[model samples]
Target: MKDAAKLFAYFFAVVIGGALLAPPLFWTAPHFSAFFAKFDFESFFHRALLICALAFLWPLLRSLRLRSFRDLQLDENRHALRDVVAGILLATVPLFVATIALIGTRIFLLKNAVPWNALGAVLAAAIVVP
Candidate 1:
């Protein structure tokens, strides 16, 4: 019952947080001309929110139990920056490679040349979203 209730609350939080955060995240996402013609803010935001929720859910659960930040197993060395950097790398590299491949294959639906800034923005989103 305790676990069930926690799950329910987490689910509710994800839905609500996703809805609230989606607009800003979608609005700020790098607007690149893609095969799709226009960015779908609604879909993008929802997806981003879901990804973030899944990625952070464990830490969220621990925090909810009133665990100290240090107790979260953030890192043994107590340096969280390294962990965060590692996480960003782990998340972004594959996505970056796949994005390149998709664009190269014309599967990404980019209608125009991908500008460096646009690519940078996408990379930023990729890093930040997870």
Candidate 2:
């Protein structure tokens, strides 16, 4: 088979196998939510599954045998810092503005009783997701 076709076959096989096995494999998987007796925003099982899935694909990617980072245009740009800042602003500014407008217009009420644990989860997500 052609390399591309082989890669596609491997990818599909993994995807299908994962889907078929997901239910029974993860039914009793460890998760952060077990501590609280409630669903935590974070999950150990999810992260593990993601890592496993990515690992399964790594061999296929390695077989591609690309030249350099620059050849794939994956090299760092000189304006990377500026571009990152711009991207963050572009994503967050609208959300911030909309939040402000909603609060000002009283469309969305600010909850005075905030849960500390919820704040911790948000902080965790910010750190881990980035």
Specify the highest-lDDT model's number.
Answer: 1
* Per-model CA lDDT versus the true structure: 0.70, 0.63
TM-score of 1: 0.40
Backbone collision tally, model 1:
5
* Per-structure clash totals for the candidates: 5, 0
Q: State how far residue 66 of model 1 sits from its true place (Å).
A: 13
Show where candidate 1 strays beyond 4 Å: 31-37, 63-130
Clashing pairs in 1: 34-109, 34-110, 34-111, 35-109, 35-110
In model 1, state the lDDT of residue 82: 93
lDDT of 1 by residue, 70-91 (tens): 6556546686899899999999
Error of 1 at 82 (Å): 37
Model 2 CA deviation exceeding 4 Å by range = 1-7, 30-52, 66-76, 118-130
Clashes of 2: 0
